[model samples]
Target: MRIALGERASGGSARDQVYLALREAIISAELEPGRRLSENELAELLGVSRTPVREALVRLRDERLVAIVPQLGTFVTLISTEGVADAAFVREALECAAIRLAAQRAGEDALAELQANLAAQDRAQAAGDAEAFDGLDEALHRSLCELSGHEIAWDLSRRANGHLDRVRRLSLPEPGYLGEMVAEHRQVVAAVAAGDPDRAEEALRHHLRMVLSGLGHIRAAHPDFFEEPAD
Candidate 1:
């Protein structure tokens, strides 16, 4: 709830802006799970009216990132393994399919863009800039999806990836994680450059699955962030 609207607060409609801000906060764990939300306070904090805050919460509820109780009020939903699995499935299905097409259709220029992104990722990793690497990581996948001539692949994956993203963000601090990620990225890009659709799919699939590999460790370390098992 202490999230600042900050500089990315412009451009989008009030509701869209609010939705993105709240979603990012929740995914980054800045807002934390199970925290009660006050529409009035959120409106005041984001310098918006309650109408937009209400609308944004509605969107978030649809994403299962928050729950609205009849009289008790809204609260950030605890992370659920089911939610994370659903996200992973959606992202893997879309991106894996897209990478196949990207490998088949990628021209030299398109491959160059991906190479440039990988180089940037390497630089970010070397500099110990996790934030920059995160953005670059997203850009690389987006560029690959775009290369498939299906921008919606990335769009849909992004919308479905909230829970998966939280796990990913938390895994950033694992020793050698950034370097391993960059190396995996290189393998994916190399396959695409070789115009080997099968190889590209294999590499991308492995990379995507690796993101889920640390989930157990993360959940163990931050039990408060996850939902309790149902009785």
Candidate 2:
């Protein structure tokens, strides 16, 4: 599959830029699961040398977003159910713990910011702006993690989220999915606003697990995007 590479952003090393670009393409399914990758072609497309392209692929390999096969070539990895579950587990653990701390510490202004984000999510959903909703979704989660005074919760969760994100991107087109997500976010935000740590954690946990609930449906809809069962 052909992909139009976006222009390089200002700042950051070429390797980091290339890594972010390739990683985004993979997560967005622009590169696509199991698509063959050519280092030379990628380098040419990105207007960089093969060195940065190879380095970026190595990083993606570490993230399990791509695999390098000997005597064959590099190809995007098929979505792994095991990988998705692992990511969910990590995300739930970190974010649940973070939400508890956030509930205890969040001030009115912080809560208002979160509520505003939810409002933005609603507007994005109403406008049929999936990309906008996606960003607001991320912003809401990051705000919760930051409120815990440990932003690394989000960083770690995101690093482990490549496969899970593909499933999320695919699920976006499902009817009422965005509305359901906004309602769940309201529950979590309400709990946090009430300063009830236990309730907040529970609500957030439920919301996070809800993401996994759609996985089976998504895999069925895009069977070719996932890994085949082992013999």
Candidate 3:
């Protein structure tokens, strides 16, 4: 399948566009684990020049999504349980603080935006549209961070989700996974809306821990995709 840039393509740098497109595909499992990548093939598939495709591949490799071999072409890296757990820790800590700050701010506009996000999530869950739900899940959390006056924390949190991205994508197909997440998100938002710091913190903590809660079943179901757990 071909990669296409979003609205940012019109004004953004070509290399950046290529990077974002390829990264999204990799993260969303569109490319899948262990898929081989060649700059020439990718350029052809994406219908772009080899230079930008090559540049994008370099960045993806740096992100640990693509591994370069001396003789072999680039391959998608397997998911690391360690990576996911570490990221979850960072995300939980940061988000707990964010929700506390958001509670303090409790601006009407931010609360409205969060409520709107919940409404969209409800529709996605009813439709069982995991991809849509995942996108909105990300947006809702980032919105809380931004509203809490900690946009940089959100950026930092996103960088830590490389392996977690795969787990989230893998879990999306499970029955009621996203729907369960919708309810957790609603709890977090409800706390934010009510301006309750303690409740917001607790809800955000629970929401973040949901990633850990499903690790057992996911690893059992997709052993090939996961790295062996450390002793």
By TM-score, the best candidate is: 1
Q: Model 1 off-target regions past 4 Å? A: 6-10
Task: Give every collision pair in model 3.
Answer: none
TM-score of each candidate?
0.94, 0.93, 0.92
Give lDDT tens digits, candidate 2, residues 125-230: 9998887888799889999999999999999998998888888988887999999999999999999999999999999999988869988899899999999876
Candidate 1 per-residue C-alpha lDDT over 127-204 given as tens digits, one digit per residue, 9 for 90 to 100: 998878888998899999999999999999998998888889888888899999999999999999999999999999
All models: lDDT? 0.90, 0.90, 0.83
* lDDT tens readout by residue for model 3, 39-106: 88788876789999888888878768889898887898877888788889888888788879988897
Better of 1 and 3 by TM-score: 1
> What is the full ranking by TM-score, best candidate first?
1, 2, 3
Off by over 4 Å in 2: 1-11
Q: Which 10 successive residues of model 1 have the least lDDT summed? A: 1-10
